[model samples]
Target: MPDPTDVEKARSQRRAWEQNELRDFLERQPESQQEYRSASGLPVQRVYTPEDIADTPFEDIGLPGQYPFLRGPYPTMYRARPWTMRQIAGFGTGPDTNGRFRYLIAQGQTGLSVDFDMPTLMGYDSDDPRSFGEVGREGVAIDTLDDMADLFDGIDLERISVSMTINPSAWILLAMYVALAKSRSLDLAKLSGTTQADILKEYIAQKEWIYPIRPSMRIVRDMIVYGAEHLPRYNPVNISGYHMSEAGATAIQELAFTIANGIAYVEQVAATGLAVDCFAPRLSFYFVAQADFFEEVAKFRAARRIWAKIMKQRFGARKPESMRLRFHCQTAAMTLTKAQPLNNIVRTAFEALSAVLGGAQSLHTNGLDEAYAIPSEMAMKVALRTQQIIAEETRITEVVDPLGGSYYVEAMTNEIEEAVNRILKEVEELGGAVAAIEAGYFQRGLADSAYTSARAQASGKRTVIGVNKYVEAPQKDAIEIHRNDPDVEARQIQRVKAVRASRDNSRVATLLDALAEQARNPSANLMPITIELVEARASMGEIVKRLREVFGSYAESPTF
Candidate 1:
């Protein structure tokens, strides 16, 4: 920490410089803008000094791996090992996406992230009427255990980490993954992966939920308990803020809302007679690294500090792992532009850099062509190489929290932490995340922020190069956009139908009945029965339908 007397002296000198020298300079050559502000609308001073963080306690900004974890969650950060480069890939049938997965691995991707189509994400079979024409449009379609097998055909589950970006039907996918591992004679405890079972965020921002909040929370609790007891290496729920950010939340809102959702999950799980330390250590987070480089970096730092304090002070967590807020970062897809599509590569690279500087555990760089469609093979390789260049070429990984003591970064970190704490308090007063979601608090906040951002862009307050500034004339298409397989829906439906025909209807019906009976029991853990249902060759839609009969469904109230 800097000496208080020196800080005071510096502050006095700074005021003098600003009053005389800066005033004269500005008069001679006016600044670009009247005032400068961050992407979150917070003021950004012309220059930062030690005086800016004079009031901040030294302990609050401790070394990496220490309590509060402002610098980072790990002691060595990227020194021991670089973050896992997990580029997301999914489109068309399970086999099709599996090809992409294999390609990414061959190109040096360390982990796999699955992106599911709308039908699969919504717990619908490819043959279902609601799933027609949408089976494999946006992402891969997985309806049965057979599809899960095809998706990970030759991949070694025990050796590689996989992440599934599914919400409403996340449990069904997780069950299929477990069933697949078992069929391969793999140890469940040795499998490491993540299921984005954050139903609360689905209700708050993503809007892709099935069961009501309480029932959905119950399902998430069941997964947490099961993972703690069985799949110890797996992260049961990746409480995510990425959707919220893409839906138009400020950086602070994303951090605060995500941590609040994490808190809600902890409370729900703790209510199930489980110790916080037992499962909290496996809880992970997902966030978006947006365009605001410094703000994004500060947001990640503040997230670790805030979560550590919340786990230790509020939840009585004793284990250091429980307090560590490990997260996976994805470069913001919303920032990608269709105008100058290739420019998205630069945007993604900078965002990926911010994630690395902020000490992300894992990262996914967006493909350059993602603004128009799913990434082509070439674009995916470029995105993967961006991380490779950062990890190998750039020497940034040699040090931990390279910007730890910067006056600007520390001040920004403190500001973001304070702002997030205020929002967390508001969430608590609203009776927690579920209650707030029901009251449309989060929805309203997101909508307002989105509107504000849109207005800013329209009025030229925000400088989105291709969209609002440095405009360029439209030209002929220069890059090929990825197109989904036109016959994917038919193929997926046929595969799902074949699986149903091969399985015994009587056994599937019996298993689903047992699952419904267990689901009706408030104290019953649904994971075991769900796993059994998947193993019996029952489709995901069948299992979800059975649970829906027992738990009903959710409908969000409209908010202006």
Candidate 2:
């Protein structure tokens, strides 16, 4: 490390240069924005210098894959292999989605992400009156193991990684996945994928919750423990900040609250007698890459650093793999504007670049038409092409941590790391994530930040090209919207009813009764029973109904 006195001398000289040379130049040409701040509201300086991070030691910001992985998790990173091109795909029936999945895979997509419709996300059968017209409207509807089997038909589970984006009812989907793999005679140990089973985030932001908070957490804990024991190659829970960011959280709140949630999960599993290292290595994260390019990059760096320290120091994690934080990223859907939809292509490119520069392990770029509806086939292809252009054409993958030593990037990384730490401290004082969540601390913080952002946009403080500053004529007719088949609901209802009728009612009842009996025990692991229920052709609604009886439904408080 360099001497502190030498660093101070260099900083003093730089300050003199700024005062004498830069000040006179700035008087003639002012900046465009009156106040500079990140999407997270951290102050941005006109210029950064070594002095800004003089106290940050070189050892603290070490080489890639090292402890406190601020630089990058893997030393070679994209140089060895570009980030996994995972496209989020779903809309219509399982077979419909399976076709789209095959299309993307043939188009060079390396991984798959499934998005479930509202009813499936909420654990409702397509035949439920509550489902009505919502069946397969927003995403694919998976009511049973047959749907899951169709979703991955002709595709090898042992070869491809699939990420299912369903919460509140995530365990049901995982069970269906395991049962489908068994049907194919594939080893469960060979299957690799992630289930977005982070139920805590539902209460904090998305609100797609079913059971009460504590009981829901119990289900998530069961999944983690079961996955560690059986599905060694799979990530049972993808603790996500993507939804929180989409719901309008500042980047800092997203990182802080997410890490706090991870802390809570580690504690929950450890309390079950599983060591932190046993499960922490499989614990992956999902985050959003927003419009503020450099800030988003810095946020990713700070996130890895913070998680490394937390796992190593706070939890006393022994393994290096356990401490290293790995995450997947998606471009911000909230930032896309329907007005000049072509502009979203450029916006997504920049956001994707931020994730790459920040060392994302996998990424999904939002389609140009995503802000309006499910992407058309053309739009989805264009989105995948965008990532291909970045990975192949840009030549950014030639180096690791390409912007590691830049003054502005380094200073911003330090600033974000400090700010996120302070917020984590606050969360800790509130008795960890669950307590903070129950008290409405995380929710209120996000709400306030969202309000501030809305005000900024409304008052012209923030310039969103198509929404606020750059006016444009409406092109509702010109944009091609991907419409779900009108008969989808009727068809899904019929299929579900057929499956229910074919199964023996007596055996279904016995399995459900056993599930309820197990739910009554606080120490039971729910995955084994869930897998059995799914394998028995038990409908999603039947299983969810049984668990709901044991773990009552949740209703959020109006105030929070």
Candidate 3:
């Protein structure tokens, strides 16, 4: 901590600079905008001094890996080991995605993130009528254990951390992963990965929910409990603000809403007779690194602080690990543009840097061509290289929390933390995340923020370089678009049919019946039964169909 007298002297110096030095500078050249603000509309000052953070206590911004974790979650941070570089790979058939996964791993990518097709995400099979034409269009198609096996083919699951970006059908995919590991004689305890099983975000932003809030939350709880007890290395749920942020939430809103969702899950899990420490330590988060460089960095810092307090005070968690907020970050896909596709490379680089500075445990940089479609192989390689350059070339990792004591960053961190807490309090008053979702509170806030941002971009208030400011003439041959394989859907459909034909129908039916029975039982942990169903050769669609009969489908209420 600095001397109070020195801080006071610095305050005087700041006043003098504004009065004389800044006045003369402004007279010579006027400021560009009448008001400077961040992407989330937080006011930005021209200069910051010690006076900005004079009132803050030293303990509030303690050392890295300490209480509150404002500096960072780990003490050495990237110095000990750089964040895991994960490229989200999934497109075409299972074999196609598996090939891409191998390419990325061979390129030195450290982690794996799987993207599921629209049908897979929505819990539909490739052969279902509703899934026609859309199968394997957006991502890889997985209809059964065979597809899951093909997806991971020769990869060592025990070594690589896998992140599955699916929610509605996350449980089934997780089960398939477990079954695959068991078949290979791999210990379930050693398998590492995250099931992006945050269903509240589905109702709040993505709208990919299968069951209604109550039963869906039950599934989340079951996974948390099971993961805590059995799969200690696997993160059952990645409480995500990435989708919510992409859908138009401000940084503060994203932080608040994501934590609110996390609080709900903690409560739900605790209700299952599990101690807070049992599951809290395994709870991880996923967030987006948007274009606001300082603001994004500050948001991550503040998130760690807020979460530490919540786990300790709110939930009575005693373990330090339980209080530490571990998270994975991805570059904001919404920030990418098709107008000048190559410019996205620069955008992703800066966002990736922000995530690194903010202390992400793992990160996925968006591919330059992702604005148009799934990234091409070259585009994906470039994204992976972006992270490598930051981790290796930049000596920024040499120092932990290099920006910890910066006046501007500290001020921003405090501002974000306070604002997030205020919003979280509002959520608590509205009866937690589920109640807020049902009452359209979260949805309305996200929609309004999104509309506001869209309008700002349209009106040129928020300048998106390629989309708003830069004017480029149309050229058909300038940028390459990654086209989806036309044969992908047919191949996926035939593969699923072939697997069904080969599997034992009677055994599959019996397993499905057992799963449905377990689903109906209020106290049952669904993970074990889900694993059994997958082992019995039950297809993703068949298992979801059986559970849907018990949980029923959800239809969101219109919120304007």
Candidate 4:
């Protein structure tokens, strides 16, 4: 810590310099912008000094793996092991995506991140009319356990960590994964992966939900308790800020709302007579690494500090693991531009670098051609190599929290943490995350921020390199756009139909009835029955339809 007398002396000197040398320099050669602000609209100072972080306690910014964990969650960070390189890949039929999965693994990718199409994500079978022409368009289509098997046919579940990006029907997909593992005689305790089963974010941002909010939270709670007792290594729910960020949340809103949601989950699960420590360790997060370099870094650091304090003070958690905030980051896909096409590579690289500096446990870099469609094979390879180059060539991982003590970074981290706490307090006053969502608080906040950002960009206040400032000519045939398989829908429909034909209809009907009965109880652990339903060859649509009959569908209010 700096001496108080010296700090005051430095502050006096800084004020004098600002009025004299700085003022004269600015008069001679003006700055680029009259006012500078972060992507989140936080005011950026002309220069940060020790006076900026004078009020921050030394212990709050202590060494890595310490309490409050502002530096990082682990002592070694990337030195003991590099962050998992998980490039999301899923398109067309299960087999088609399986090929891409194999391709990624062979290219030195360390983890699997699955992206599901609209049908699967909405809990519909590929053969459903609502799913026609949309099967496997955005991502892979999985309607049955057979599809899940095909998706991970050659991959070993025990060795690789798989992240499933689904929300509304996330538990069903998790069931399929567990059933597939059981069919192959694998131990559930040893399986490691994450499921984006954060239904709250769907209501708050993504708008891809099936059941009403309260019922959906019940299902999430069931999954958390089950994962705690059964699959200890698997992360049942990845409380995500990525969707909210992509949906146009500013950095402070993203962190605040995400932490608030996590608090809600912890409260709901703890109400089930389960100890916080039992399940909190496995609770994880997902965030987006945006273009604002320093702001994004500070966001991640503040995320850890805020979560640690919440777990320790609010929840009375005794274990260190319960307080640690582990997150996987993906580069902002919304920032990619189709005009220059190749410039996305540089954008993704910088975003990825910020994620590393902020201490992400795993990361996914967006491909160059993503602005047009799902990334092509070549584009994905380039994105994967981006992580490789950072890990092997950059030498950044050799040191832990390299920017830990920087004056600007420390000040920014403190400011972000304070801002997030204020938002969390507001959410609590509004009766928690679910109530806030129902009141359209989060939705309205997102809309307001998005509108502000769009207006800024349109008015030339915010400059996007290729899109706004550079004024580059549109390139033709600059990159290969990923084309969807025309027969993917047909093949997927046939596969689901075949599984239905071959399955035990009587057992499936009985299991679906049992599932409905248990779902009505409100306290029953649904994971076991859900797993059994998939094992009996029940389609995803059947399971979801049964639950929907009991839970009913959700329709967002338009007033917000």
Which residue pairs overlap in candidate 1's backbone? none
RMSD of each: 1.0, 1.3, 1.2, 1.0
- Count backbone overlaps in model 2: 0
> Regarding TM-score, does 1 or 3 come out ahead?
1
Instruction: Report the backbone clash tally of model 1.
Output: 0
Misplaced by over 4 Å in model 1 are none
lDDT digits (tens) for residues 1-560 of candidate 4:
55678679879999999999999999999999889888877889988877888787798898899889888999999999999999998988888999999999999999999999999999889999999889999999999999999999899999999999999899999998999999999999999999999999999999999999999999999999999999999999999999999988999999999999999999999999999999999999999999999999999999999999999999999999999999999999989988888899999999999999999999999999998999999999999999999999999999999998888888888889889999999999999999999999999999988888888889888888877898877767888899978988888898989998999999999999999999999889899999999999999999999999999999988533
lDDT of 3 at 19: 92
lDDT of 3 by residue, 1-560 (tens): 46799899998888898899999999999999899988777899988888888889999999999999988899999888999999998888888999999999999999999999999999999999989988988889999998999999999999999999999899899989989998999998899999999999999998898998899999999888889988999999999999999999999999999999999999999998899988899999999999999999999999999999999999999999999999999999999988878899999999999999999999999989887778888899899999999999998999998889998999999999889988899999999989999899999998899999999989998889967887787556556767888988888989989988998899888888888898888899898988888887788888888889999999978665
How do the candidates rank by lDDT, highest first?
Answer: 4, 1, 3, 2
Among these predictions, the greatest lDDT belongs to 4
Question: lDDT for each of the candidates?
Answer: 0.92, 0.90, 0.91, 0.93
> What's each prediction's clash count?
0, 0, 0, 0
Instruction: Check candidate 2 and list the clashing pairs.
Output: none
Lowest lDDT block of 10, candidate 4: 1-10
Clash pairs (backbone) in predicted model 4: none
